[model samples]
Target chain A: MNGLDPGPLLFFVFGWFFALNIKGITDRTYRQASRFVPMIGGSVTLRIMGWIWIFVGGTLLALDFLG
Target chain B: MGAGWGGGGIGYSITLAETQTPDGKTQIGILTSKSVHSAGADFGLSATAGKFYSNADDIGQLEGKGLDKGGSAKFGLGLYGNHQTEVGTTNSKGEGVNVIEYGLGAGLGAEIGGGYSDAKSRWQTEIGSDKK
Candidate 1:
């Protein structure tokens, strides 16, 4: 709790939400968002993206704390 | 193009996209989207009614896919807005989607749009160039 930037924390939370795979939220986001590749399954793509966000957030948080 | 088991469909869209540069320089271009779904099959077409900001793009598309029971034709309207700011560009746009669905085994819809592009272009030009 070094009072570091909270941006990474916010990303972590959003990542968790996406990884949770709430059906309605996933569906609506899939319908509305502009995807880099539209042919992929929305659920699968979102899950992968969520994990990436989690990883990025965690790494940044760790860096903030260590630095 | 896309496919699904229980419900799925394929959709394609084309848009005349407007790209903006910092200090608000803008150019018109094109964007295309092709998608395939494997859940809840349906066929639909969407057209852009209006748009603003960096994305003042007009889009139109026709798509179909679905293997189900009874089929029906449907219509829908959607409004959307997007804004983006980066080092090189900052943009904002408001747009609408008009959809019409026509389903063979499932359901289908279609959309049509017009009359907004000209106004958007003029407005973008004025705001980007700081003209009155």
Candidate 2:
């Protein structure tokens, strides 16, 4: 019930999401010569996941602050 | 933390982790470079601790968890210190370089990590940059 407790949770979640998105992007680019269609799908999927993280993190922080 | 996508000299990493229970505790993370670059890998570790926002009434929280390429580039050992708070995060890192081949350098960085203060401080010295 302390004020700072949520900070770390938020950090961990964001870190996880950030790392995942980066990995997806790097992988798609690396395989560009072999597969072109899959790269598009991969990029879209990564973007969606990145947005999801932002939304979830923002919502949690807002709720925490509001209460 | 940030995610970037590009071509040529690009690097990426992903980690999925979970810990049972809930208690605000410090978590540490380590990163080291690989053979891709002759400058060698860069190693770093960081610690984080805070509370849970999900259950506002709940107390205690716990959690834990870069780049570029080539040319004359640079290489050395470094040390960093960082702190994170609701306001923001501040970090500084320092390292050393040898001018033409090696020397010394240091750097500091600060950013907001999920509303938590984050910072890193480091110092690095070029151990062996003239081996070529």
Candidate 3:
């Protein structure tokens, strides 16, 4: 309540959660598609974006910690 | 790893991504799907590209070469081509085969997202090189 505001903190946490969920879903989707479909690359791009979000969210959380 | 089945069909997809570095440089990647639809089968492909700024030192320093941080967004599109076949009930002693209708389509999309990093690095450099 003093140094860091609760609003940004909550936002960061929510972002992190969303990112993790996306990553998990994408990973599963990719694996399944790759196995059966053979031609469907559903997992690769989505997973890449998922990782990007995870990294960005992690960096934000890290900044909050350092702050 | 996406898997879904709907009778028999074909589809295609294209995706593009752009990211900005902390130093203000932008990177872009493009991916396109060649064959997405097949009868009793599926296929896919993935491609990526990444680039960053590079500056030389000494004499190059006079010319200026360094990484810069900026902002970027990503866009994606999907195209679909399909063909399907089916079998229908035979009438009496006759044989019957149904030819299902199949077609192609194009999908388009765009998204804008960016990030900001801590300004400490720039600030520190500025303060360290202060002429005052």
TM-score of each: 0.29, 0.22, 0.26
Model 2, span B47-117: residue lDDT tens: 21112122111111111111222221111112222221212111211211100111111111111111121
Candidate no. 3 TM-score: 0.26
Better of 1 and 2 by DockQ: 2
lDDT of 3 at A18: 33
CAPRI classification of candidate 2 = incorrect
DockQ comparisons of all candidates to the true complex? 0.02, 0.02, 0.02
Where does the lowest 10-residue lDDT sum fall in candidate 2 chain B?
A: B96-105
Superposed model 3: Cα runs more than 4 Å off: A1-24, A27-41, B1-128
Give the alpha carbon lDDT tens digit for every residue of A20-49 in model 1. 765655445556543422333444555554
Q: Candidates' lDDT values, in order?
A: 0.36, 0.26, 0.28
DockQ of 1: 0.02
Over B1-132, each residue of candidate 3 has an lDDT whose tens digit, in order, gives 111123222222222323333344443433222222223222222112333122211111111111112211221113322121112323223433111111221111211111111111100111122256
Fnat value of model 2: 0.00
Error of 1 at A32 (Å): 4.0
Candidate 1 versus truth, CA RMSD in Å, comes to 16.2
